[model samples]
Target: MDHKRDKEAVLHLYNKILPPLAEKIYQNLTEVTPLFDDFHLEKVVDTWTKDRNTTSEKEISLENGNVQQMGLRLRLNGFQAAGAQTFDLSKDLVFLLEYSTYTVGPDKNTRWLEKPYLESWTSKEMEETASRWCEEIIDEITQKLQTL
Candidate 1:
């Protein structure tokens, strides 16, 4: 069986999902409540990476159709000024997080522990599953970002 098709299909699913995910994360950060009176959420740096932040050399490689790693690196920083009425660009790194996804298993919870190999699902099925998982991840990440 040609795994190339499966890899292509999986990559396609991620390609469609990543942009909106990044946008949602950015949007959430924009709405964050400052922890201090003068604290500001000045700059948000978000980028999509094919590399796995968890690994050393295997940072970027799609081994088999299932063992793929992709993530969004988020850097949000702000500054606290003495009595600033308005917040402007300042570098006071508040939080940095990378939300990663692994297409390793059928169950979301057990995905990391289980060995990864692409399931032979149709494109539509894969799309639905990937969308659902991304939604869950987005919600979780958004909440965490807001809380920070």
Candidate 2:
């Protein structure tokens, strides 16, 4: 696998997901409802890793069929700000959380290799799964980010 292309995939995910997640978190912060409280918190994406797995059967035919590549995994870590200890009402007041997830999709080169028998089905299923998971993760993280 080309390292440069792999690196680009990682960066692509970071650029695609982080901004919306951060924006929702920021809006949640400003609302300051009963669910929201003032606290010092910082969020950062630790890093991403290359995914070698390809979901496309076409790509699989070219190489090993059983492998699933995790193109990039984004680990979001955060810590509660200082002088905000009062927010620690719960003993488990976790100031830090790391949400790590990966993205997988067929690139242009791999598109032609997809097995005609299962291309659309596999693609749709994977896409739906990714969408649901990402939504759940973003919702959970946004809630936590606001609380912190």
Candidate 3:
């Protein structure tokens, strides 16, 4: 698991796995009608981490009036280690979501409200965690949207 191999795997996950899954999620959300009329799936380009390594991210968002109603982002971070004659590499997938509403205060100040959720999973648990978390978030959002 050299850097090249590690990068390749990351690319495979970013390019091969996420796009179709995001599309499926988008399609499902669309079926829910007005709640998800503004929902969109976006491919975030490569981003540099604090250590200067590259990471990939994707986002799904629903917007209302000039504000973000709900959003979810998935980011992948990779790492590598070298032994005497061996190499080990791994990655973590981080999922983030913001569930929020807006409020106008008595003083006439507008405030954007939010409840944030974050979860991280290792490469070995990527598939299970991704599927489970995405479905859970979608269900929760759908329920919440129906009330709005």
Q: How many clashes in each candidate? A: 0, 8, 0
Which window of 10 residues has the lowest lDDT sum in candidate 1? 89-98
Candidate models: Cα lDDT each: 0.36, 0.33, 0.32
Which residue ranges in model 1 land beyond 4 Å of their true spot?
1-6, 33-67, 81-148
Please give the lDDT score at residue 24 for candidate 1: 48
Per-residue accuracy of model 1 over 1-148 as CA lDDT, tens digit each: 3233234544543455445544444444443324223422222222334334345443232333233334343323343334533332222211112122234322323342221223333455445544444454446544544554
Query: Runs in model 2 with CA error above 4 Å?
Result: 1-5, 33-43, 47-85, 88-148
Better of 1 and 2 by lDDT: 1
Per-residue lDDT tens digits of candidate 3, residues 1-148? Answer: 1222233333443465456545554554443323221333454422322212323232321211111121234321221213222211211223222122122111123232211112222343434434554565556544544544
- The positional error of residue 84 in candidate 3, measured at the CA in angstroms, is 62
Q: Kindly report which residue pairs in candidate 2 clash with one another.
A: 40-81, 51-70, 51-71, 52-69, 53-68, 53-69, 58-113, 58-114
- Number of the candidate with higher TM-score, 1 or 3: 3
Give lDDT tens digits, candidate 2, residues 1-148: 2222233333443354334433443443343323324333232332232233533333221122222232223233333445432332211111111123233232213321222111123444434434543454456655665776
lDDT of 1 at 116: 21
TM-score to true structure, per model: 0.32, 0.28, 0.36
